[model samples]
Target: MSEGKVANSNRAEQREQLSVAATATDGVQVLNPAGEIDHHTGDALRHALDVALTAHPRVVVDLGGVTFMDSSGINVLIAAHHALTQAGGWLRLAAPTDTVMRTLQIVGVDAVIDCHDTLRQALAD
Candidate 1:
């Protein structure tokens, strides 16, 4: 778990806010985000996605560690999805908590992007 942890040096002092790896799962880039994602921390997620996409367009954002999310996070995902799709790749969301899942559902992002109940399912698909 300690492996492939992308430092949060560019975003915040809390390094645990995001963990990223180009090939964390089946050669697919994975981003593990923790804590609440809001206006203040949304840029961190965005930056993480930017870095992830540079290595590979396909990415799976593991949201199991995320507790809360707002419009800012949704916008970040939408942008990342657009970028990946344009490159002939895709973005997948995995293991979102109930609250976060509800946020995605309410925003209709669940319909636009692929959402999975588990990280395994997301990567397997």
Candidate 2:
């Protein structure tokens, strides 16, 4: 299940440039979101994660394509992590861009969700 789609939030006048999509291969689910994941676009990410979780237990979110992320994005990830944890599953973030990685570190999100330098490394774990 590898597909892509652009989502528009309720911010009527302002169209969203953010895109959130997912792909599942070899028992690992990967979510790829581009552009900013702020209040307007966080819902898109949450929905994508929900779908991905339903299909795979071990989920790896590939953040290499993301340009920016705010607390809303972090909240989505945390929620996904909690859901997966409750289901005896897990979530990991892989290939985050420098900015995204720095944000995760500063917010202590990395402490909860493991961050890998590569998708392969995350899948291996």
Please provide, for model 2 over 12-55, each residue's C-alpha lDDT reduced to its tens digit, 9 standing for 90 to 100.
32445678777787888888887788898888889888998888
lDDT of 1: 0.86
Clashing pairs in 2: none
Q: What is the C-alpha lDDT of each candidate?
A: 0.86, 0.86
Every model's TM-score: 0.82, 0.84
Q: What would the per-residue lDDT of candidate 1 be over residues 1-125, giving only the tens digit for each residue?
A: 33334443533556335443335666689898888788878888899899888888789999998988899999999999999999888999999999999999998999999999999999999
What does the lDDT read for residue 90 in candidate 2? 95
Predicted structure 2: clash tally: 0
Give the lDDT of residue 62 in candidate 2.
89
Residue 68 miss distance in model 2 (angstroms): 0.5
Query: Could you tell me which 10 consecutive residues in candidate 1 have the lowest summed lDDT?
Result: 1-10
- Model 2 spans > 4 angstroms off: 1-15
Q: Give the TM-score of candidate 2.
A: 0.84
